[model samples]
Target: MTTPQDLLIIAMDVTSSRDIGQGDLSLALAGAELVDLIEAGALTLDDDRIVPGAAWTLDDALLSEAVSSLVRQEPYESVEDWLWRRGRDLFAAYRAAVEAQTPVAAGRRRWNPLRGGPAERADSPARRRAEDRWSKGDPVLVGLAAAVGIEHPDGEGAAPADEAVGTVLDAVHDAETELEAVRQRRSIENAAFDNIWRAP
Candidate 1:
């Protein structure tokens, strides 16, 4: 499975006190897609700008779409610009894509006293691969997961070896931090508005 798909699966499987924000997840997913594209030689980073390589035919439909959406003109998009533009509602897109691929049960099951209901997700190779990567502390995966608030048990993983991938990861972290700041400002503004209305 693709990194974006694996990330979405992990986010869904995780249980955290603070809910994962879709905006943060979307930015991270965009970063993951860029990392995979760089690994595949589909694109390269000229400084912080993304430079598209020769036309590529990706096997994954969503990835192919990502390639198609690249800003091919001169002075290509910066990593931060790409994150905000392409990442818009990206979490919902990945969620829908994953849900469409998952199999649905046709028959209803009888209630059981001892055993729990069917598992949320069937045991699958994709999930196994994701879990393995997560457990092994794959740097890129770990970095992307952390951007979305998924902490590693043994602390943060090492930084990515590739400079370009590291650039993307850094952009993801900055974007997530900026999003969080926006949330805090909104929360404070909302609280102020409530206090004003409640004042005698």
Candidate 2:
């Protein structure tokens, strides 16, 4: 399975005390896509900017679309910019794709560990592979998961050996932090509004 797919599965499979925010997952998913593209030789990172590589075919439809979405012109998009632009509602897209691939019963909602429901996917090879990677603490997967607030089972994961991959991971963390700040600001504003309304 691809990195983004594995990451999505991991997010869905998470049994964390709190639900992973959709915004956080979307940013992490974008970062996973970039990491996979770099591995596939579809792109490279020049500092923080993405430099698209030679034309290539990706077997995965979503990944192929990601390639198509790359900024081919010079001064290509920075990893941080790409994460925000491509990550918009990315969680919903991946969730729909996974649900499409995995069949569900007529009336039952798929079990999500975070949501506490019945299991959705059967014991498939893809899932087993993702689980194996998570269990072994694959650096890239661990990094992306951590950005979205999912800690490794054995604490923090080691940094990836690949410099480019590490760059992408760092971008994901920065973007997630920025998003969280925005959330906090909105929360504070809403609370102030509520206090004003409740004042004597």
Best by lDDT: 2
Q: How far is candidate 2 from the true structure (C-alpha RMSD, Å)?
A: 2.2
Candidate RMSDs in Å, in order, are 5.0, 2.2
Candidate achieving the largest TM-score: 2
Task: Write model 2 residue lDDT over 89-161, tens digit each, in one string.
Answer: 8888787776665445466577543456335566667777888899999999989898887788787768999
List of clashing residue pairs for candidate 2: 111-117, 111-118
- Per-residue lDDT of 85 in model 2: 95
lDDT of 2 at 50: 96
Query: What C-alpha lDDT, on a 0 to 100 scale, does residue 19 get in candidate 1?
Result: 59
Q: Write the per-residue lDDT of candidate 1 for residues 68-146, one digit (tens) a residue.
A: 9999998999999999999998888887775555432245342221233322665567777887888898898888888
- Model 1: lDDT equals 0.82
Off by over 4 Å in 2: 102-108, 111-120
